[model samples]
Target: MAAACGLTAAATMLPLVLGGGSGDGARPGGRPLAQAPPAKAPGAVPAKAETCTDPEASLQPSSADGPTIDRIKKAGHLVVGVDQNSFRWGYRDPATGRLDGFDIALVRAIAKNILGSESKVTYRAIPTNQRIEALQEGKVDIVVRTMTVNCERIKQAAFSTAYFQAGQQVLAPKGSPITGYNDTLKGRKVCTATGSTAYDALKAKSYGAVFADTATAQRTVPNQLDCLVKLQLGLVDAVVTDNALAAGQAAQDPAVDLKGDPFTTEYYGVATKLGNDDLVRRINQVLVDYRKGGNESPWMKAYRRWLAADLKGITGPPAPKYR
Candidate 1:
């Protein structure tokens, strides 16, 4: 949280020093503090609802029957879990001092569909490894943090239909002897975020790099961007992350380049605590409409704004698939 938003412990405490304001209302300086949106169980269902996934391919509209949706409506906002590091996906924009990126736009769309206002979103910055645990612990209502859906994660949380497609790829400094995910990694000090599939892949030795001896060379960090930082500071030889995120990191520093063709296929999904089928369904509904086809679609507009360049010619909101 502190790292992603660049907020210090003092940043949070400064709020308490200044006296009375409503939840996330005006502070002494009038800037709203990040606060949990006021909420409770709603007496009725929300009349306005929307989604960002392929609507033509989506199931019938979101029933919005879940207790989670009711609680969110009554609270008057949606609490969304997101990333503050991965570029173009969910990083904080320094120019505006606001979290802005592809994933964040999706989160805001969910807030709008459910709460009738995009600004009703309360952002929670979570690290890569903590995304699932945060959802289970109820730290945030739903995690839209570029989390990849996979069998191992399904046991921990319920996921909406796959909303975005990503793949594991290697990132390294430009002009480095390392050309890609190959023999070049035989003895390199590679870095991956703790709890990410990229780290798991390294642990499993799935990249075919034979170790000369049992000296641990893998570095792990809490956020994917930290690995990039390590690379920049000469702490690690390379970073492994989703192509979408790696693209963002590369943009952050032109000296770095996505080192190779993606080595794995993965899907991104909105996740909730296991068995929260209600919340899962509601989020799935958001995905469905958000991807509705056409240049006018919200998803496309956001893509053009943030990711079109990094992703190059790749087309679309990966076809949606339900549980």
Candidate 2:
């Protein structure tokens, strides 16, 4: 039920100009980018504590044959919720007009395993804010849209093992003096999509009380990529998103670059409906068995083709740990 062309219109995006791109972007664990993560702002209410299993913590395998499998087998297709503007994670390729990215690659593999055809699936383009609610509402069978696992989300939905590692970071114009996650944001307006970790990070004490009584970037959008549009239009000073996503945006627009070290480490997981532990277990096993083919693994091939350059040094799937 997915028309690749329709995803282009649904995705809130900034048109990319791919010419004369630079190779001098930031890299993790090496020459640092931006400033060291700032200390927690004094007396600012801390980010919500995750008292439950971390959303992206390592995932262990499980025997998944159950009703969920029977349901999918009966339907003969997988319905997946994903982002269309997340650049290399999940996006509509302007040239080919097809949905592609690292996450899309995973969807194809899961589809192949369950439905016997990689393309035997329906794509539901969901915004970041609606990811969990869509699952809870029974609107989709799986979500692979750079979703972070956290205690609050587990209350409503289930998540697969950690699939990708990410961290909250800043994006800004080429020569802006905003160094790292520091005072450079005093009078600056930043943008983040609603229902995102980046939005939550902005409110956390350490990243400056962005939403505090003080002056900060007060704008919120429906999609994280829209923040980049605000920056392009000079509507906001910068955009805050995961470094992984910012890397893709930077590639799309040479005018912007990742400005600082990622302030917090996070992980991305596949999300499914609550009480769908059978499906959850099945997905986790899929992840565990994804790369056994070694050099022929689809995960490696896609990463090398799309993500290796932007996310320097990433070479393999995240190791899984079972609960």
Candidate 3:
């Protein structure tokens, strides 16, 4: 029965990526790459919040019991939504027919801690835009995508304390003239996932960059090697994605490199439906316990296994708080 379930899940994923489902929103055809306008440095003060209420403070976890933990316990499984396309964060191995990455490892650890077995996890591969919505609709219990825990996201879902710190960065082919975010690539096309924070940040910087939907961006030349393959083929001058993702790309292909230091550091956190305090608290406890023990925790071991190359020589304390 378990084998059948896994096969069904895998079948569901294949069409989604092969452009056969409603999920494939846009096709990948575009004009030749144009140079993007020079972008200003990223440290400009953010515009004042028009809405006075703090999103984070408003969504604070309560001590009251919530449905998420109860649902997991009753089902005897942990349903985690994650990005299956990201290399270091989450992706499937064709040879092993298994999904693995830093985020997957962490989710497995959470399942083991909560259900006493790692096998109790049911992985749901989710698109970037659907992560929070999936959680809110009860389609998944938790979202462990490389999702940023921002004030805006907190408005919709509760977030675990940060598990990884990342920032916005640019990926360019080797020897590209673009040195950093501030470099002028004016009139040059830059590719970024549609509806992503990287796009938002680049827009905010007034880079006048072009945008491509994520699916389209992934299909262009060299096939899923990295987000910046378009740049390597000169389809676009640059690609903007998370710094961690950029790092992984650089590690894999010496021909591609991350340009400039990352601007605007943000924390990656697990996301759950709004008002699920009991589950949030339980997860928080597990996170706190993991931190106290350093990299000895199961989560850390998993991190090392899947992300050792990206996280090489890096050591740090665990996150300060959970949900």
Cα misplacement distance, residue 308 of candidate 1 (Å): 0.5
Q: For candidate 1, lDDT tens digit of each residue in 1-323?
A: 21422422212221112123234322122212011111221221111111223321323347566777777777776666777666788765555567778888888888878788889876767778778767766666788888877666766887787667666778888978776666678767788888887776666553454322225544777777777766877877888777788987777677789875766656677887776667777777887788786666777788889898888664567666543
lDDT of 2 by residue, 1-323 (tens): 12322333455453421212223311112110111232333332322323444455534566557888778767667778888787788887777778889999999988887777888777777777788766766667899998877777767778888777677777888988776567777667778888887787776633442432224434788778777776777777788887889998887777789876766666678898878777887788788777666656767788788897888776576666465
Task: Give the range where candidate 1 is weakest over 10 consecutive residues by summed lDDT.
Answer: 41-50
Which candidate do you rate higher for lDDT, 1 or 3? 1
- lDDT of all predictions: 0.66, 0.70, 0.61
Candidate 3 weakest lDDT stretch, 10 residues: 28-37
Please give, for residues 172-214, the per-residue lDDT of candidate 3 as tens digits. 8778777767645565577776546676677677355554445
Off by over 4 Å in 1: 1-61, 206-218
Prediction-by-prediction clash tally = 12, 8, 12
Pairs that collide, model 2: 34-260, 35-180, 55-149, 55-150, 59-321, 59-322, 60-321, 60-322
- Deviation from native of the Cα of residue 172 in model 1, angstroms: 0.7
Model 2 ranges off by over 4 Å: 1-60, 206-218, 293-296
State the local distance difference test value for candidate 1.
0.66
| TM-score of predicted structure 2 | 0.81
The parts of candidate 3 lying over 4 Å away from their true place are 1-66, 212-226, 321-323
Higher-scoring candidate on lDDT, 1 or 2: 2
